[model samples]
Target: MGEPKIRRLDGRFDDPEIETAFMRDSWAGIRVQAALTLIGFSLAWIVSTATDLMYMQDSPYFLPTLSARLLAGSVGLLGGAWVLMARPGSDSRDLPLIVYGWILMSTLTAVIVASVFPTAEATPDGVADVLVFTSSWMSLHVLAIGVALAAFPWGIAFMSIAYMITYLILAVVWNEQSEHPMIAQSVVVVACCFFAWLMAITFSMRARRRFYITRLYEQAKIAAEKAQEFSSFLLAATGHDIRQPIYALDLNASMLEELVDAEQWDKVKPLVQRQKLVASNVASMLSSVLELSYLDNAKRPVTPTTCDAGRLLRDSVSGLKDVALSRGMALHCEPCSARIQVDSGVAGHILSNLISNAITHSKGSRLLVGARRAGQFIDLVVADNGAGMGDRDLFLESRSALARINGGQPLRSGMGMEIMFRLAERGDLALRITSRPGHGVMACLRCPRV
Candidate 1:
């Protein structure tokens, strides 16, 4: 039976499900907003016209003539048309047009009301006229402000300041000598202040939501990348560590059978022992890889130990000697005595993988491992006189096995390299690779000497 596959969560913002949800929500919000705008405008128009008609004969409360009403209606309709028909996507430009249109309509309505209305009877008392004008103006301004705030709440403070200045100028500089100018001015001021406060609160909430969304996006991207890295690592580790030993065991078992057939009883015991050893090594390697993966994912605590780096590299080279010899390659370990503080087992694994990789890819029959000291750091280099990689091959990392190892093509090198890199990263070391076509490939692990 095949191993169960692990399914990862799709957290990308551009995922079909997420995109659909966002679009659905945005469209619903827009439709509702449009409907509300239309309703509000209709109500305002009906109320203003009805009130004017109801007090037609009273002082400062006369109905506008049909011609005047038609003119004002035409202007208001044109303004609404411009707002609704202009490019909706261009909010920055469209917002100004919307606001200006509302202001223009309100001003036109005020003018028509003033012209048709009769003069006040005594002391020019026209409180009703003043109230109608102020109320209409404030209502239109508030609508404009609300729309602006909804579109871009961050800019609400600036909009609030502008609205405040306009309101103050109109109430103070252009004050008509109505009986209740003070009351009209006070109402306008209070309405503008309330709207400004609402805008401030809305902007604050929007900023907080935006911050949280941005943080979530960044975290999701990082998690996706980490998951991809882990998946690649697991695939490579399975191919190299798990499969290789099984192959070795099968080869040794076949050899044992041939020895028994030839009546060479002496060789059977050693062959069986070697096969068992290979199986044990495979198990150990698998355990180590699993542990490393677990530690990386869980951010496990690590206890550092001091060990001899030179001895570790030498042992790693020794272990790969038989493998290299089988492929007609010589694995060489240059003399070095540099001692560094690190996990000996992890260091050995890194060196073993690097040397084995060099042997596998070598075309010239030799792989060299060497180390040198430079100030407070030690640089270990693994070089192979292989049909050396080009710049493209040397820099290639995180590619899949099937994509790389097809029909006798060279096995992918990045899995081992990534493991080496992760080890180096955990140990606060630096790993660098340099290669030239037809010359050789070299990898250096530079770690601080302690």
Candidate 2:
């Protein structure tokens, strides 16, 4: 979170995987540099040989220059071959190897140049010509190598410093060249190398920052997909495992209704009815869970058709009548004949959750469920007249209650509200809730009138 934990000296990421990812991103550039190294140095060696044969055949420095060029060219070929063949992997160390190879080749090239400078005074034009040639070579070498070392800021710095040190040593050894003093030359070369180091740092940092953001985005996408997959799996397993028992209980309840004797029926009928009511409530709760899961995944499809809003309201209320009765509350449905254009199944589920939530959490003795025509839309309403709730209580979800529950507080019973809200949203229906503490609570679902 704070500057991303990079190493102070080498700029390597503290996390090895992160470092490896950066290296992988740099691999293509490294390979290209290797290829250029092989081709560029081969041409340089041939040119130098030809130039010596044409102009400097009798010069004392000709053999030494030819030998140095040959040795440096051979080293460059070998190092370039190794770099070209190397592939980045899980190891964060692979990138450093490429950088070190470049450094070694650059150092060898510097040694070849440095060896010629000490004896520049012996040339026909004295040290001036040698000074001009060395300056041009150093400038061109630094600029070319810097471009080839793209995406590796630290490597560029190291190579530049190595070359500078080689030049400085040569300058010290050739102090006899008084006309164009070696000390002044060393200072200019050092400044150029240092400036290149700074530029390389800026370029590499920007590249690493981009790679970091991309990696984070990919990781987040994968995590989200896996979470959705896990949610779907859990929903499927829960529906199967829980529905089997509920289904068996339903079958047993039907069998009991048929097989019981008339004498025992009077007493047993109530128990069977209670069992059915409990089973129905469980099934309804399960349906709510499934609906919520579907909505979370954005996979629930809504098909709007002409539906009797009145019948839906009555059916939802009727299913939860026992729950209301058990809680010593009276459930009522107002008369209505409104029709609406909405997905019947989705609307039914929303109505059921609304009615069930009121039955369980309204804490009121009187509950009302009804629907009425309101211009272009039919509005289904569930209102409770018991001890009302606050706006916060109306919207508080079950998950948010976990912290309170852990602190020895009662968990809020608003999971149903959350589910109903999502279901209504998916069906393109409007849901609204109004609650006032100690007054009452009312919820409305608005649908297109048919």
Candidate 3:
């Protein structure tokens, strides 16, 4: 055998549907942020204004700068409300960037409000205390927003960096004459920002892991449902497979009784053969189902022992030779002497499945079973000279995907393909198929040689 070819990358990354899914996940976060920001802006402004009026009543700058403060709060309100109005399901990729814009606009409003009025010296106690209370309330707002932004880790990071920088700038440039402990404020603000970022990351990981697990559950549910459907299809399609054999057995039973009554010993030979053939058919169908259940349930498997690969193939082929001849086909095993480690019964089952599939579906006149040493492994090859599939996709999907029962190039026993796949996987064997439409198929099973 030659080396396998390297596969090229041809994945669908820029798919439009993928972008839509991304938007759906993000839309919830953006909507929540918008609603909260709008509410926060309204409450922050109303409280600050009412206090400024009561505390700074004597300050000359208070009355004149009141209008400028109102304008800043109004800007934040309008930005939040506007973002909230945009339909959440929209396919626009810039919605996240737009949310960032809202952040910038609010930050700008805060800066403008700061520059509008100077801290008055006359009512230092009243003015300073009111401002201090407002700043404390604002710190709590930052903490609340950090918790809300947990769904979007990147957004939390951006907000944390921006707010930390804003705090440092205000502490140095605006609090020069303030009697408050600016150093303590700076330290607390910086520490809180770091904590917020870590908290959001923890929340994001938990949320994403939960979503991934949910997806796996859905896929498993779908597989179980598909298996049920396949079972139903098996009953419908193989109705003849069961009926024909049973009908033959009934006829043979009647003939066997008459031959015995007449005491014709030689005449009963053909009737006995007919009874055995029909019984074998019934047994084969039931046995396939039983084998499938055994593999699926993860039953304990037998241990492998060193055996002659040549004899295994020869014995399996011999058993199927009569069936092949009945269908006007030929089966043979290539001479091999290489010893390999395998559970002989399981290996025989695998060989029987591959050979039976070839006889039934291969449309081939001849099939050759062979084995050879490849490096440290042994390759069990089943090659058929028959028209393969319309495409390799069907070949690759033989396990989960259904073959057309009546759509038919002899898709006999679903057990043949499905069982082979599961058994190969359980036994830790490497299975590969090589074929095209016009050409035949070669199922290569590779396992370690002892």
Candidate 4:
């Protein structure tokens, strides 16, 4: 078996489910972060403005449009808050575009409005005007792009390109009116724009790297803990379950030895048969354990072919009929005409566990196994008129967590359902359980119909 492929947040995953989940989560966080940062900064700006502590409040360029920028910022803040609940994770693509547009519109309008506003009793220093404009505009550019770094690197890349162009245009406009060292100052501004882009790229990737490593670490820790737990439970479980047949075998062996010593040959054949039954039961138990090991490591390769659904059902129940009858229960299967595409052994094993579980633990006279076609799929169900699981929701929550044997009252490994879960996961089969406490549990395995 190959190693499990790790899911990466920055790149594609081989598994469709993993890829979808990673993208959904990544975008969700990005949208929420972007929205909150915009709203939070707007709130901070309002508080500072009310206290008359704005850094560039006295600057000439900002003095002309401070009220206008504040109004725009407040409006944008309301829009951000509106989107906090209206947008879902799937709508993340449009979120960046909308946010970038809002920032661009507000900042550009403020700059354009301020650039035209004439200063009465004008000072003869043009470079001083450029310096004031640069001071205010550079801060706006930095703040706008700075809030976007939490979004994925892809969105940040697009934003950085657009913002760099916007900054360059602002630099060119201001350069026309500035006197000395204008070229050098423009170059520095562009360099700073580039630096902001590079910083966004660096920090975004770092955040993703941290999240990916953390995901792998958490998954590894959980898997290790579960493995340890299952191991400890299996050791004690095998001892208790295997002891019955082993004790029966010991008794039969002693009986056979006494019969042989007494020359009572008549009873030898019956005793041998009983010994075979006990041995066979032990062999079956061992086989189940081995199969679980294979499934755990995903070592078993599934090769599906066309097979009769009815024959599959019968084959699954055939081995368990004797055991079920011995427990005063009847095993019945309704024939299915639908043909299915599945590994017959795998499907049969899943059905066998479900039916055998019904037989061993359910308080009922009859166990019903059947299959039927439903559009492109066929559902194979095992149901009995017996006491069902106390917590049906928990049974469906996690098979590993519900490690109680046979879906019964005792605290034992829910080994059958756990095995069914592994097989269903490997086969891409849909398994569902429905039960009422006094009604019964219906375990359904849905396979693709051929």
Candidate 5:
């Protein structure tokens, strides 16, 4: 046969590759968050440096000005650490609390540092210089606002409370003596309050968007699972209904052969033989269809028992000898004499599907089925020398062949494989498939040795 023209289903690729990509993307998001926090801190630091230079020589509040800058920078470092450690197994919930605590501490420290500095005279030229100088201290406030906006919107509520307490203390201590202190304190209070409100709004909008995305993802997942369940039900019903008639036909065909004689067999012998052949083919097709459907649904119950692994393998292969011969393929079973505790029906089903799959896909004359005791388990393998599947195809259908049940659908065409997978899962067996194009395929199913 020419090389099998392999094609994969749309948007369906290897699971491990997709998982790796998801982890990379998640790490990238965390890095972006850390970078944004750093940029906000940098801007605040630059403003503090300019303010410190303006009031350097004669300013009584020079020391306090330096203290505010140090506090803000420290808070920025803490925030960066929080983002860095926000990995899957790490404490994600505690991060927001840590950031909130840092912001609260920075705000209280800034308020104390600002109060220690004496108010300068409101000269025309000095007013502009003082405003520029004070703006550097405002960086701490900006950083606090940014933290509230970026992490969780509700976190601003805690920061706002901390800012209010700090503002009240400064209002009572610094503005009590000056006649115009109320005017100066009011300006600062209004500016901080407005910025906090704005940050709150921004946080709410972002939170809403995140909530919507999460809901949509959950809905999609539930829908996919439901669809899979429905497919399994359809396959089970089809198998049960279709197999009953086929079994009856096989029995009747066998009975008819026994009643006929050789003397008058010339006329009736050919018709009976033809009827039996037709019945057998019909039964084979129906059985395949049912097996495929059952496998696809994979809902069968498993009953594990202790049995001879070698004996089970022999019986399964004996049943497939005629099938292999008819397809011009050889079937051989070599079993290790060991007892295994497993779901016997599931083990049998798995072997059946592997053997049938090998015959269907192979152009080779021989197939091999065997098992060996490995540690506490028996490793069973079915190998075929036929037109083997490519890596991409093997990867796609190895876990669940339900995707290949329809020819037009570019998925496994039978329920038998799905049933086999479900059985393996229930039996706690390790099932693996390996295939190389033009070489052949090998399927391994491992179960605990009794």
Candidate 6:
């Protein structure tokens, strides 16, 4: 009815499933990146240590440079261990891990630059070389963050700003001895920050889009499978249910032919009636199946009207009276003056289906239809004192009855109950069915009272 809410690529979503999935997927990649970072830092530390010992051991910045590299490598090792050991399914921890790695990487870069820069011999050419070296070193960390850890745009912005602030603070502390100009260093920091932010947004948006496409594809595949199953169930159920009635009709036709040849006029009337009854049953079954199918697939709107509950109950029973009588069952209705607000047609169909099902399957001598008044509602009940169904049978009936229409397992004789259930749902009525072994089955449809 309205525009769907847009999901911002902030690593949090309104839907918990999407949020959990995004975090889980990102964590997988994050773990691999963490391992790679650990290796890279370790290799860098080893190479830098060897270079310092062989060539730059006499330099004033040598100890600080070596110390900074060791610190960075240690941080990388700790981060990698933590990320790898933590469960990827722990969605709440992934963001913290990314932020933690970014902080360590950024702070270490600032420490190394600040400690070594102030002690360097200042020269025009030397300043340019130093800036180039620092920028190149910083860019690696920036790229690692951008490519490895999938972060929210705001998180990237925060890490970038925090790094710049830390660098500026360190630069201010040693401003006098610093060889590089503040503006040049600031420019480099800003550029790296902007790049990281841009990458974060771009990667997040792409991930969300991919997730949506994958989700839709999965849903479509499931629906296709369900449709195929439903088709197979339909064919099997229709064949099994329709065959009995058609066979009865054929047997009646043969008997009628025999009776006519003998000129048995008295039995002819009842035999023809029996044939019509069998044909009627076939038609009813087909109609119920078609209606149930339509109800399952289509959105049918219900228009409620005030109706006399007693009259509605009586009418439903009266229509099915002949069918019940044919099976030697007595159908009775108790009087109730309660008026209910409901979709009368749907309600009537639901009642008739319930009555028919009881008459056909209950194998009982008596069926009762009645209305009872409750506070603000009236319960239209159709109960049968038949051989009764056990708890398992009732459970199966309730489960497979309507679920079968929607591609679930089919019950051989559940169409009538399925029709009743579907109509009750469409009409927004609460239908409850309860049964006990040797105590028969009772169905109650609760409707709003006028």
Ten residues in sequence with the least summed lDDT for candidate 4: 115-124
Per-residue lDDT, model 1, residue 383, is 84
- What's the TM-score of every candidate structure? 0.53, 0.52, 0.50, 0.62, 0.52, 0.65
RMSD to the true structure for each prediction, in A, is 11.4, 16.2, 11.0, 7.1, 11.8, 6.9
- Model 6 lDDT tens row, 98-187: 546645564564556544653464555564555556555665666566655544456566666766665565446544544555566767
Name the candidate, 5 or 6, with the larger lDDT value. Answer: 6
lDDT tens digits, residues 1-450, model 4?
233354233233456665455567576676677777668656654554542234344556554355655765686687678668776556445676656656665555444443443232134365446555654555455545654643544444454455456545545665544453345545565666556656665665555456567678888898787667656644554553454455556667887999999999998997787677667656766675555444334475566789999988876665565567667888888988889998765676567667767876777788999987789999998998887765443345335544553554433423356656655765567788766777877888888899
Best by TM-score: 6
Per-residue lDDT for 88-198 in model 3, tens only? 455554445555554555444444444333354435454345345434543555566567655545555666676667666656655645556466666776777776777
The residue-by-residue lDDT of candidate 2 on 32-104, one tens digit each, is: 6655665575457645667556545576877766766666666566656665665444344654564566466
Candidate 3 root-mean-square deviation in Å:
11.0
Checking candidate 4 for backbone clashes, the offending pairs are 403-414, 404-412, 405-412
> Which tens-of-lDDT digit does each residue in 53-90 have in candidate 5?
67543676666666666666666675665466553322
Candidate 3 Cα outliers beyond 4 Å, as residue runs: 1-86, 114-134, 174-176, 213-243, 258-271, 294-450
Q: Extract clashing residue pairs from model 2.
A: 364-386
Residue pairs clashing in model 1 are 363-386
Identify the superior model by lDDT, candidate 1 or candidate 4. Answer: 4
